[model samples]
Target chain A: MKWDFTSVFANTDALLAGAAGTLRIFAICLVLGLSLGLVVGLGRYARTWWFYLPATAFVEFFRNTPVLVQILWFYFALPMLLPFEISPLMAASLGISLNSAAFSAEIYRAGIQSIDRGQWDGARALGMRWAQAMRRIVLPQAIKRMLPALTNRAIEIFKMTTLASAVAYVELLQQGKLIASLNYNPIEAYTAVAVIFLVFLWPLVQFTYVLERRLKRDE
Target chain B: MAYQWDFTPVLANAPLLAQGLLNTLKVTGTSLVFGLALGLALALLRLSSRRTFAWPAGLVIEVFRTTPPLVQLFWFFFALPLLVGIEMTAFMAAVVTFSIQSAAFFAEVFRGGIVSIERGQWDGARAIGMNHGQALRRIVLPQAVKRMIPAFMERAIELMKTTTLVATISYADLLFAANEIAQKTFRPLETFTVAALIYFVVIFAFSLVARQFERRLAVSGESTVR
Candidate 1:
């Protein structure tokens, strides 16, 4: 019938607070997920059973299950096994970070695998150790190729930050829920939230496209 | 005290969990079918020469792809009914949100697959006295669809995982069932673990099958679209 956004705009402070929560979790998960992914990715790429098998299992389990389930498990179920309770932020971050790690591990492994054996041979000829070769030679080139995919993963992590709301983690969507119910402006409130996300993510999505195209051309 | 793990309560509610699994499959299957069809249509429209057709399709794909599925689900479930003056069921909202959300992803896969087909195929079809639609249906799509299988299977697996969101909207999906059993039995640790395992088994099987297909495709020397 009628459209109104005043209710949404009036709650700018609440939305701003929500945005901070969303960003905090996003930053936490992004850093933890990607860094841990590199380790797990190396493990997956390893020939040793001790390294590979557990990495493989972790990737499969986390990748196969829905993230919401993981968050809920950490929030509700895990406390029973531990001496203390898990906070909403901690549980959500753990679930999202682990899930992102599993997904990104594959990306990292692929990127690492894409490097030619000659590079390794060259590194060996230069008297470099395995870690030295990986750090100095292989990963530098591999990261260039992995840029688009990794950026895409970053965008995914940003979108997934909303799932923190499922645990009442005070993220954007959770705040939108509060706004909608309090103001009885579900349409305006939800629409505002969606627009805010689109605003936040559209540029990142476009950047990925640009990176993909550039990578395509350079390769 | 070390918590003693028990599965008896979770095991006793097997039927409920089974029903939830069925519902999960139902949503995944329904959404997959619709998403594929809508995605193809969107892809075709996006590839059209006319700006009118292409622009709108691009908008839909970009908007849906950019937004979080959970937000989309909430909008459909809570906001849409009031906007349109209709009673919306949780299942209807879940299906609608997931279908269009997945369709956005599928559209790109379709577009990529279609474009990956060389220009010569279209020229050859046109030379054979085939119109655009017939050429696409008989020649282009068959070949493109083959390259798309791996990507399609991957998206389908993602869709199944995403269907868990319906539990949030009060749909009795597997994750929701886990919640109910956990609350009823106060064995959340066991209940959630089992639920996670059930999801893993089903989704992992699909992943394995998809990998098998990918291997066979590779053996056939057919390069696939992402």
Candidate 2:
């Protein structure tokens, strides 16, 4: 078969649908990741032995290891440890979210720790409880510090969703693989996938730069 | 037929596990050297005097850095051979892909150090009649390298974890072995956990070494600066 470069985009509709699936996964995983990360990050900062020990273990294991293994474990082995059945996509989301949470927790812990002690005292003087003070004052401020790193990490997780191809999710990378199998044009199939990702990321790159500049000027 | 992890399978496969560990380190070691070399060249090119040189280098860095390593790995394994008509073995493909992909990141980090090596140092090197390359190798790189140790170690740990992605293309790295065990015994939990542990050990050891190197380099750098 002659090498074909334009065949993967033969059906624009299917490509768009695949892009939607990828973004959907991204949105779901990001929300789940931040929530889980919040708890882990607080645990790290609080230094409560219970939360600290477990959070440290969780963060270290996930951060130091490969997300691919985490995904495979969730899809292939995790459900067996439980009584309920889970779909592959759910499994992918859970694994990616958990792995990402580990990272976000580290970032959050660092971001929160970077805040000045003066802020905490001011909050206490304002008659706020520890929880209230953290929510209203500390978190917002820390999140600003965390945003740039978080943006970089978010881009990382977005790129990693391509690995969902392993557990048989039809995200963009897997979709491109399937297209390649059918059309026998791997370059166009994968290049089209790269182009699709570039479209998502190029804007994100600019947005991160703008956010950084905006944050810098505000500070 | 319920499944719970029994270590017997992993224990029995100890030799294979050792082989996997060695392979992971080999890939990491070789790629670090090769990636650093390519990355340095790219970093130099990006900071070159000519616009034509800088633009293409910047483009290459953006393309690889923004994209996923898995895509790059797959592209090289499945498409590059077809695109360029040269077949690579699975291991070769992994090294090539990782070195090329990681060079983008390595270059950026290196660029940070090179650009920050105090403008006076560059002037001094030029005053002594050193060309750009000599100035870099003799004066700029030594100073930049001292500060760059921390970043290099961090990137190394990242590269180690990235080796697992090569498993997707049937490369028998640690994760691929774990995948085989998972498939045969339906014990993905045990296999992957153990695999994760092996990676952690490799990474942690590297971290310890990196810390030592950092300390040593700090002493040398301080003396040299003085």
Top candidate by DockQ: 1
Residue-level lDDT of model 1, residues A1-219, one tens digit each, is 699999899999999999999999999999999999999999999999999999999999899999999999999999998999899999999999999999999999999999999999999999999999999999999999999999999999999999899899998999999999999999989999999999999999999999999999999
Candidate 1 at A210: error in angstroms? 0.5
Fnat by candidate, in order:
0.88, 0.65
Candidate 1 ranges with C-alpha deviation above 4 Å: none
The runs of at least 3 residues in candidate 2 whose Cα sits more than 4 Å from the true structure, single-residue gaps closed, are A1-3, A214-219, B1-4, B211-226
Residue A70, model 2, lDDT:
80
Give lDDT: candidate 1, residue B10.
Answer: 94
Q: Report the lDDT tens digits of candidate 2 across residue range A1-219.
A: 355666765856667777887888899889899889889989888857997999988887778778887888788778778888767788889888998999999899999898899999999999999999899999999999889889987898899888888887878888888888988888788888888888889888778878888987988
Model 2: chain B TM-score relative to the native chain B: 0.90
**Top of the candidates by lDDT:** 1
Clashing pairs in 2: none
